[model samples]
Target: MQEAAHTGVSEKSTIAPRKVLRHSVRGQILDALRAALVDGELAPGEIYSGPALGERFGVSATPVREAMQQLALEGAVECLPNRGFRVLTRTPRALAELAEVRALLEVPVMLRLARTLPASVWDSLRPAAAATADAAVVGDLPGYADADRAFHRAVLSLAGNEQLLQVAEDLHRRSQWPLPGAPRVRRADLVADAAEHVALLEALVAGDLAVVESLVREHFAGAAV
Candidate 1:
């Protein structure tokens, strides 16, 4: 029952979904851990035991361990054989490299799609863009992250390259994890970033390739989760 885990568990509201789904306990815990990572609840370099987290979440240590293993696969945590799991520290250089890679993979595809995809396709993503904005207004980092990814996924799916889309998404998720010594994320920052989705969609629908390209690059430049 370390204080850090208690603090993380107390702020679990940031990770809780509005509506409960049919996810298994392990699946649910996995989502919760990811959200916690995004919100900086899981402090970098801190080791948390599965049994302790399981006790807090009211489940067996087995489920928590399973979830932690999944996170380890995602590079979010490292397993400590005789202890627990340690959240990995992400450096500025690493984060910047990820953003650059995302731009490299997504920008060209999105720019090309802007020219050919019908306005209707862009219009369909409006709801997701709006959802991100709404989540930001309430400082719901986890919700904003989910909505943001959904919007990007919708746009990239148009390229009909499932593998590319999946790889970009994995990078995007890692980008959202809070960096050590980073200032607490502000509501204004979230709102501005969320608005980029709307702006990008507008540019796509209006057939403004230059604006779309600029917006896409700008989006990655500030892709600060």
Candidate 2:
């Protein structure tokens, strides 16, 4: 999926308005499905019909099928001939492998950023951090997921490397896919993750590389998501 960069798309950025009209419908449906996967509304291993999902999202089956096809390319789902798609299930071993990838990518960069970036750089992320906390307090898993993604993206943006951000962002999304047979998210877990972001930012501002590294490792170590 390294070629994903070839599309010249930053998942979070603004797009041309004309292009938005043509692409946003399918893209939005894809995003909604991704959130459903992470939020467990689309349970892993379940075969879901495009028409059925279209009914759920109030869209036509054509767009839903297109979106699911994109997700299938991302390895999030598998297409069945003449049928719908099946949500790909991730085992604990798979989750652990993903966590290891994230730790390798995120930890060292955070340590480097903590020492080099200015206090205001970390301060710039406070709004995303606050947004994460607000979503966590409300026990909104999808909301927290978005906010958490933004917060980490903001952090990695400081690296001045779009490729790094994109790669890490992809792994981050994969890591967040809901575990098969996992329990619903606990409010306490979201709150704890929010607190970790806060501390991570504080460490970044303090230029405490050790604390920043520790927090980054611990954050990925708890892989309930």
Candidate 3:
């Protein structure tokens, strides 16, 4: 009789487990650092040391160093020759340009999604937008920021185009700049934004692609201003 074939898991399964662990570690570090940078907890021009960050994150320096290198590659942080990592600061002009790019990329995708996706997806976005409005009302900037990200993500997800979603995400990250000494999201602005979302939802429900696109463009323009 032929020798019994091995019944154990394949080598690929063993290697895959380690790969997943490493990826999770790296992703955790990156997300924590990115949140700090965006929320102004890590100020512009502040130099970050790997050891310090590693300690703070309860990890060793290796993962933190890897994360910083990845961030530098993404242009979110700059590596000094001998010093450390510095967060990249965006100028007003640069922010405006990024906003324009975001509008161009996102609005069209949202419009297409609105016209094509099922109404249920649009309905699901309402709660996220309402939460964003509530956060703004309570002066919870971080909460508002989280909700804002969710709202946009929901809209992009409806597009059903992975490539376009990736492009929009890249643009969104680049658009995070200090708001010229203004609050990140003021109560009034939040209210207006919520209204705009409602209008977009109404247009989507009506299958009015033209109105949806116009509203999206106007919303971005208002935010950019």
Candidate 4:
């Protein structure tokens, strides 16, 4: 078995409730693979076998292979010749380019939301930000990661453009994947990072576009996980 598919990894690090509920078995496998990629259980440049991943997830190899194919299509993993998939590695340059694109795409949208959206719209999204805070308080990286994305998604969804949201989400997921050779991020840092959401929310509520712009710009400047 490749070392990446170790069944003993903590339950939180693997796909659980949301993926299982919203996605097909193959979709769930694909999401798990993404989380594994982000959480560094599946290292860059490692070839992971479908059968081994099936054993870990308690699914058959067919679904695992299908899911892996999807990941390959997304360029998150590469389909090996007569084998399984190899996780792709990203350089600092690549990660920076992703962050740059996200800032270019998302930051302006967020600034516009802050300027044009009413307080009630931001009000409805407060719970998502709080959920991120809750996740951070407990030092839960996986939980924080999910909640953080939700909070941002809620903010972006207000633009009333699903296709834009979809594109932004793809970039977001790519940014979350682990950067090659970056140090393991500390849990305390995650807690600190989550705190910024509340601050950004406050700035939005206050209608301070300057602070909001700065916050949104800095928000995309996340350390590699």
- Please report the candidate that would top TM-score against the real structure: 1
Models ranked on lDDT? 1, 2, 4, 3
- TM-scores of all models? 0.90, 0.87, 0.74, 0.86
Comparison by lDDT, 3 against 4, better one: 4
Residue 89, candidate 3: Cα error in Å is 1.7
Those runs of model 2 whose alpha carbons end farther than 4 Å from true positions after fitting are: 1-23
The segments of candidate 4 whose C-alpha lies over 4 angstroms from its true place after superposition are 1-23, 223-225
Q: What are the per-residue Cα lDDT tens digits for candidate 1 across 1-225?
A: 445554442323222332324459889889888877888778887777787677667777898899999999999999987578889999989999999999999999988888888988898889989999999999988888898888888888889998998898999999888888788789999999998999988988888989999999999999649
lDDT value for candidate 4? 0.75
Ranking by TM-score: 1, 2, 4, 3
Candidate 4 steric clashes = 0
* Global lDDT of each candidate: 0.84, 0.79, 0.68, 0.75
Tens-place lDDT per residue, model 2, 1-225, is 222244322222121112123457888888788777878877788777776666566667888899999888778999886667888999889889988998888888888878777899888888888998999999988888888888888888878999999898888888888778899889899999998999888888777878888889999998445
The count of backbone overlaps in candidate 1 is: 0
Query: What would the TM-score be for candidate 3 when compared with the true structure?
Result: 0.74
Q: Per-residue CA lDDT of candidate 4, range 1-225, in tens? A: 434435332222243323244347887777677667776777777677777677678777788899888888777888875567778998879889988998899888898878888877777777898898798777766667778778778888899999988888888777777776666667788877777788888888888889888877777887323
Error of 1 at 130 (Å): 0.7
